[model samples]
Target: MNIMKRFLKYTALTVMILIIWVAAIFISMDKGWWHTPFTQDKMPNEFIASVQEELQNEFVGTMAIALFKGGKLAEESFYSNDKPADRNTVFQVASLSKFVSAIGVMKLVEDGKLNLDAPVSRYLTRWRLPHSDFDNTKVTVRRLLSHTAGLTDGLGYAGFKNPKDVQSLEASLNKAIDADPGSDGRILIGVEPGSEWRYSGGGFTVLQLMVEEVSGQSFDSYMQSEIFEPLQMHSSFYQWDENFQDRLCDFYETDGSKAAQRYYTAQAASALYTSLADLEKLFHLFDEDNVNQKPVSPEFQKLMWQVEAETLGTPIYGLGTFLYTELENGGFVIGHDGKNNPPINTAFRYNPVAKDGIIMLTTGSTNFATRIASDWVFLQTGKVDALLFTMQQGKMIQIMAIGSFFILILVASIAFVRRTGK
Candidate 1:
């Protein structure tokens, strides 16, 4: 009996040591001091499997990932045991739509139809922003695209199932611009526009109005002609088309409940349905533009990569994308992340120097997509940024550590009691 107790005691001690070691590792990883080294050569499939396992264990509903090599689509995979999610499944890439919106705006600018520094009032003839004490003239297209337009957030109208249920740009502005006439929350121009950075989903909606007015075409039609159709990005559409309905991925909420058939109407800000394979076509434009193919102007493309604005405690905003500083040569990783509903998380990051990138889309709310993108960025650059992983679960990890320690203590106590009784 004593020998048996000794064995358990040793086992319990080993368990306790392991718990502490794991706790230390997690803490170190959170603090950006540790990482699971990954190979850059071919994208370690084992690491991806591990990430997928971790995501599944955490109850993430679905995942799709694609990697680009030499600025071309190289590898792609899908993960979801609960439902049908595959390589071509279209996901509502929320804020990622903003990048496309910016691209459309830039295309017009390249043709001299729109001016960046000009006041948005030049084109938004259908509707106008409400009057405020702040100078509205400073609210230029450049500020709006860069998120420094100083406009307040609009009423979020993203989850309505019927595309028609989504309000029109004129309606969104009328409601968001004032109280009683529109929404509960009115968009406020609190500060001088262009003087500082502020994120306004409403600003993009406002741009939708400008796109229509200036081009004499519907916002969706303009994008189709100028960007998507020209680039052969057949799978991307700004609104819900019957053709994409069958290809849409199921969205899951944070509680792991499947989202009902919902469609977002914020066409400029969040209402884009696309697959990773389709997005590669859009990314290829950036690559060709980098080499001066003039799909868009070289000057405008260069500006897309330049740092435009940044807020305190957040990544730098470059045009419609966030600037990632993780890559080694100190170049830049350009892309955007999107969340349509709580459970829908997507990340797309691109490297300019090597023209390589990775796209991640998931129906999990954990922001696991960022971690996956960060891992690739790290492997490419040999430098890490933003912890790359482990930033979102500090409390859960701590609880796990403490719980494991207590379990170890309970086992040791049981062994001690057994030995004494014998």
Candidate 2:
């Protein structure tokens, strides 16, 4: 009985310690204890130097960065190997394609060719979402843009090394020809529409089909004519052009090895090629005062900023872009980040009210651009954004290790109690 009592006491102690440890971690994260606060007074040169220092690490092969202040380019730089990289250096901007694709959809809406609330099936004749248990009619363009659509194909397209291997849009839709493993490649409604927030690249691919059918042009051609050309984003394209070869930066792996160049048929979801100079033009789209040649009307742009979906009690997504962090003035920092396998990461974030933002693109480094962008937000706002929390793999691993230690202690105590009782 005495041995059993001792075991219970040890077990209780272990449980208490585990609970306390978890509480501490949550508290620390809430307080932003892991982050070093950035002061607004810091000089741009200092920030540049810090970023340059980080770039010296082996994980990064090339990076293009720009800082915007008062809706104007304050500073910009390009870092790379012996290759010639400059403001015109083009990058395959992974999921940032979604931001531009969303704009294309809204342009169609502005033209009265598409309706946000209408059934997406109304727009597409090339393909249809596979039949499922859910109400397919409820799957609307707005829900798909906001990722609240019922589609369950959580696709992340893996571009092909050879252009010949690229699947037709309809064929790829039937089975994501190069999606990441574990994702259901077949595009279909899996849940009740407007039920919850779920990230689905497959949803955007459907929008691509809608754009092509309604515009009576290829997705790339439609985006170029309706969006990129009007913005004077001369170097941005949904599909690769032979003319861009000289400007395209080679992608690389995390281990500093070169990765094969890839091509994509899922242009809306994963195939935007852009330059820093061109992306700067995109940043101005959020600037309400710069209305000379806006892509969408102020009213539609405002609609895009309005919250559409949330995760973990925080409103994290707006119409087609990410609602990153809220400002004290009740405005939000908005942008998007993109990641592709074999190490390419890109991020762009800005506070529209403050007119301050960061644009970062990297090759041979996974999530490095996002971390830096998150840090910039933390410095400006003193609050950690949702993306920062997702990047805390190291902290999570430490917590898991500590919890495992406590569990082992409890197990050992139970063994001791049993042996003594015997």
The candidate that wins on lDDT is 2
Candidate 2 local lDDT, residue 11: 75
TM-score of candidate 1 relative to the true fold: 0.77
lDDT of 1 by residue, 238-347 (tens): 86788877887877777878876565545888778888777867777777533423357657876776777854444567777678763456557888877655566788
Would you list the C-alpha lDDT of every candidate in the order shown? 0.73, 0.85
**Which candidate ranks first by TM-score, i.e. highest?**
2
Score candidate 2 by lDDT: 0.85
Runs in model 1 with CA error above 4 Å?
A: 1-31, 34-44, 154-157, 176-184, 289-294, 313-315, 326-330, 382-422
TM-score of each: 0.77, 0.90
| True lDDT of residue 92, candidate 1 | 77
